[model samples]
Target chain A: MTSKWFLKSTGTAAALSSLVLFLYANLRQPTLTEQMLPVHLKIFELDRTPQAHEQQAVLAVLKQQLGVTAVSFSQEGKTFSVTYCPDKITAEKLRAAASLNEAFKVSEKTFPPSPACPVPPLDEVKHKVLGVLRIF
Target chain B: MRKFVLYFVLALAVGMSLTACNDDKVLYEIDPNSLYSRLGGFDAISAVTDQFLANVAADNVINARFAATVANPARLQLLRNNLVDQICEAAGGPCRYKGLNMRAAHTGMNITEQEFNALVADLVAALNRFNVPEKEKNELLGILGPMKPDIVGR
Candidate 1:
């Protein structure tokens, strides 16, 4: 009889704790706003040889014309990469600058939308996956 | 009493799980027609193309050849419309391109690979001046670049 009573008391305590948690959760507000980062535009095929001062000058001109705050210049083999904010400057502007200088060739590739952008609407396969996960 | 408590705990767990699932709801989709509207549609493309042709006429490398054909604004405008339509359609937008295949259209023009590349550079500058976004610009170029096979023909 005493064991039964102890079991009952512990079960009752667990029930009360769960009840409080449920009430607190229901009262808690859901998060709505999400933070997004600025998009970057990449300019490819800039000269990367040791005498790349001309390339640097072209990049400076691009930065000034496009109103980009941050510029990253890096080399891989014979090519250089210039990554800047897409909101301010475009990849085409970079290419035009390169064309005028005759020192760089600009090619563009569009990256998948960044995580900062809300996920695109799921297709049927994605919908099925979410359904299997009971996420819908 | 113990049975009642056990059931309540189970119910709470299920409720929390269901609430967690609600966050996965789909919000919205990007409009399929956005690329057309963003590219300034037909008029803007023609305007930009006119400017691009003028720029090409002044470019030393390809200017001589380009100047000969670019004098005809009506022909250039038609070409621009076809180009924009191809770009728009390729980007999942609703525009039907009614232009000839690249090879046939550029045949016998004697457009060297260098001149073809210069035209691309000039078009890029024109699009940039018109504030076309990078993704749209690339989408447009992707359609244009594949034509190099026919346009360069070397």
Candidate 2:
């Protein structure tokens, strides 16, 4: 009987704690980014040195993508960067589109491949978590 | 009766005050050859704003200051809209700048004089890229120059 009472007390405390947390999360004011969907820049390494035509083609592919805002190749033409709305398109989608051509294969099998500075995936996680926590 | 005369006088006074308020709402008179017109109106202003943003992105001196803004598309677009509106309104165009004043916007940023000058230089470069005339460019710069005090070293 004593064990049962202890279990009940712990359960009650846990429920109350959850209620407080839920209220707090739902009540706080939304941040500036929370009000609008955020944009991200994804850079990809090209498989081979890009020719002028290949550079233009890659830019065209990314630019024609739904949420892409800006696309530019690196000075060396070995990598390119795309600024896009993640809510509308993903780096994977961009990789697929850019690799459709036989000549230029993008090394983006891993959504964010290595060889450049990363913006930290933690920001993406936080953006997604905020989206889930937001009640209204 | 005396009451009728008093009511009539009160109505006349109230009518006059309302007319005065209406005068304040009259449309602003813009000169026929205003800078806004010379700059080719809204489209030209928008083009210049886009070029300026590109220039700022490429500028190393001031690019770091705007990294966060460029990272967020919404914020970037807001900055673009505010810039276009500010320039339009300053040039006596049919636009109203509803954003925060220069001091308020740059208060916590602690912008340096060099950074501020770099920004102006970027804008000037953009105007030059568009081949804006010397007279028109100087006129626009003259209009925006006064905000330097409010924006720099704050």
Candidate 3:
């Protein structure tokens, strides 16, 4: 009788714990107010090393004109990387606004592959399951 | 023997619950048309960008920061295009941004929260010029609002 009671009590506890966890995980969902911020990065290739004045000139236009968030140049690589809000700028416009010399070449790159979109809120699925179970 | 039987039943219940939780994971569908289309597509976005830039240029607080582009028409146009593309991509349009991240971009600018707020006001004005509804404007701002930490106090 003791073993039977032990089995019954433990099984009840296990079932109860599982139900709580399932409800918590499945019901949680992000509210409408929570939105994701997006940023973009672009690189430019220069035919030759840009002079100090040239670099300054480009930086000024990028900052003042393009409203870029951050701009960096690599003297060693003869290239520059700029980070900006994509909502305000694109790689093409950044290259154009810089007004580089004829020798400079521009290439646009896409953002790296992000993981898949989040699964829908589990609460919706839970409701559907409960509804189906009711049909039995 | 009965103890083993109880353990097996408890374990089975736990396993089933775990499976149910996994099965319940659902991907919420987003309304793809909402942001992109409501903003009036590419042309309207471009027009809004133009207005926003003009507001930025006129605002004395942030105008000095934009002096480089304002002096030259070519540079000004490029800036406008950049702004439009940025907004478009952010709104889930076809355009892609290949620029730096916010923190890396705004690091040395010494931008204050006031300046950032001023910029946002200008953007709202631009959105208003085109009569972008309040809901859409709020949504757009919501998307950009998180960038404040990276942009301000740097």
Most DockQ-accurate candidate: 3
- Model 1: per-residue lDDT, tens digit, B95-119? 5565576766666666777877877
For candidate 3, give the lDDT of residue B24. Answer: 16
Where model 3 places Cα greater than 4 Å from the true spot, the runs are A1-136, B1-32, B72-78
Error of 1 at B91 (Å): 4.1
With a 3 Å backbone cut-off (N, CA, C), the pairs that clash in candidate 1 are none
Ranking of predictions according to lDDT: 2, 3, 1
> How big is the positional error of residue A72 in model 3, measured in Å on the Cα after superposition?
32
Sorting all predicted structures by TM-score, with the top scorer first, yields 2, 3, 1
**Candidate 3 lDDT, B21-45, residue by residue in tens:** 3221134333467696788876677
Docking tier of model 1: it is incorrect
DockQ for every prediction shown: 0.02, 0.03, 0.04
Better of 1 and 3 by DockQ: 3
Q: Sort candidate 3 into its docking category.
A: incorrect
Evaluating just chain A, the predictions reach TM-scores of 0.41, 0.65, 0.49
Deviation in angstroms for A71 in model 1? 30
Cα RMSD to native, each candidate? 20.9, 14.8, 16.0
lDDT of each: 0.52, 0.66, 0.59
Residue B69 in model 2: lDDT: 61
* TM-score for chain B of all predictions: 0.62, 0.80, 0.74
